[model samples]
Target: MSNREGEGKLIQVKGLIKKYGKLTAVNGVNFTVNKGEIFGLLGPNGAGKTTTIEMLVGLRKPDEGSATLGGYDVVTDVGKMKEVMGVQLQATSLFELLTVEELIEMYGSFYKKQVDIEHLIESMMLLEKKSDRVKNLSGGQKQRLAIALALVHDPDVVFLDEPTTGLDPQARRVLWDIILKLKEDGKTIVLTTHYMDEAHVLCDRIAIIDQGEIIALDTPEKLVKLLHSDNAIEFRVIEGELNWNELPNVTKVTKKSNYIYIYSSNLQETLSHLLFICKEKSIIFQDLHIRAATLEDVFISLTGRRLREE
Candidate 1:
């Protein structure tokens, strides 16, 4: 994407880099976020997703390159740029003693412009918990409150760093709806997430970062198309062993925990080969099934590893 600032492109990053002594946290990173778009940085833990967001939002200084939000340089004009930016970090520290309503109001005092506190609470699904202290809220409720605090200023650009991390599935879905509504309200969002489904559902474009460098950048559909396969086979091996990629019609292989995912160019032929190998090796497998290619498969094909590998 072009670095030229305009009405369409609200954020820009070029050759950004960060270092902690000998280790480079982010290396030569570059991208642009369009206005009213949910752009994602997708990768595993410690894959530079959080570091990149921190640098762009001025939480951590970049050692090289430059970026701008709303045409204000993130490094040099942080104060001016921050006025139009709202941030919900991966871990947000809130006043434990304050009620949800009190916390939202406290944050509102930081910005010159303020959105309706009650409306923000309603949008976050925190209306019922408005009287509850921050420490008394459930995990999901606390996350929503953190997000509400970010939006109290009604900023043009919002940075959400793994907003759904550590949340239950139901709570995660609730946050997803809130994020989508923010876009409908004309807010540009920069999202960092490791969950394949989250990135597929929420992101307009994704940057796949690994080991401090971006390996790929494209729409979710386009990224999956890179494998040149429509079918994926997944199962757990109960006995024996097989090199999945060496089997006929197989395109790629990815292993995480006890499960193995095999991508195939010809479904019937590949299944036949897999059966033959299992019989020959006396291998027993379970949960075998075929499905369509997904963002997880794309990441494995590109990086030769799982997205959330420990």
Candidate 2:
């Protein structure tokens, strides 16, 4: 589904901060999310992505700063804010004995306006498991059910924290389709994820957080373009290491273990020079791979650490 462009901002966050004793969970952070857009919070664990979401959703009061959702201040109008927003937390606890349809109905009872039970089920692709008990459903099915409950109230904005963390590739793609469908229906989405590829595929714009602060925010393509090189050539050297900076068109070089990575804009020149150098030096290069630079590389470049690493 195509995104709704030119939509006005639906969420505003300013100087958002949350503290726990001597430690700060979220430092001064700010960003806005437009209506009918998918805004992603991408960061490693304990980077405060969840804290920021909690502050925006009224689950946690910030030590400093403020946020507003759907024109209502999260602090001053938390009840009103809750009416317009739905949340699927990182760890969702559900009634194990309840059937899927019953669970949806139970959550819908909390809202004044409720969506059709059958339609919500089908929308989440849980029609086949509608009558099954929560405990009997697979991990993917349970995750979909949790999302279904979040939408039963027909919220204007939805918050998903690590929605596809543990799902397999196929199941993750299914959830991606469902999320895109929601965007097509004009619902604003705010998501936090550890998966760089997921953020690249799903988010209209991403805010990269690290050490309790937002380090960068932009569209996926724009973020990746921030790097000097757009392509990466990687291989392992068995004989000896050569000065990577001497390679033609090489912008940056990173070496981890036995593998060396060269980032370059001119892939053809870089590949040709690398091959020539390998032949001249009699360096036995193994497992050669060349691919486009990605958000993962961007994160590593920015933080000097991988997304999953502490």
- Runs of candidate 2 exceeding 4 Å displacement: 1-7, 237-239, 256-259, 282-286
Residue ranges of candidate 1 with Cα displaced over 4 Å = 1-4, 236-249, 253-260, 280-287
Give me the candidate number with maximum TM-score. 2
Task: Give per-residue CA lDDT, model 1, range 3-89, as digits (tens).
Answer: 445557798899999999999999999998999899999999999999999988888889999988888888888898778888999
User: What Cα-based lDDT does every candidate model obtain?
Assistant: 0.89, 0.89
Report clashes for each candidate as comma-separated counts. 0, 0
Using alpha carbons, what is the TM-score of model 1? 0.91
lDDT tens digits by residue: candidate 2, 139-205: 8888899899889988889999999989999999999999999999989999999999999999999
Model 2: lDDT to the true structure: 0.89
RMSD value for candidate 2: 3.4
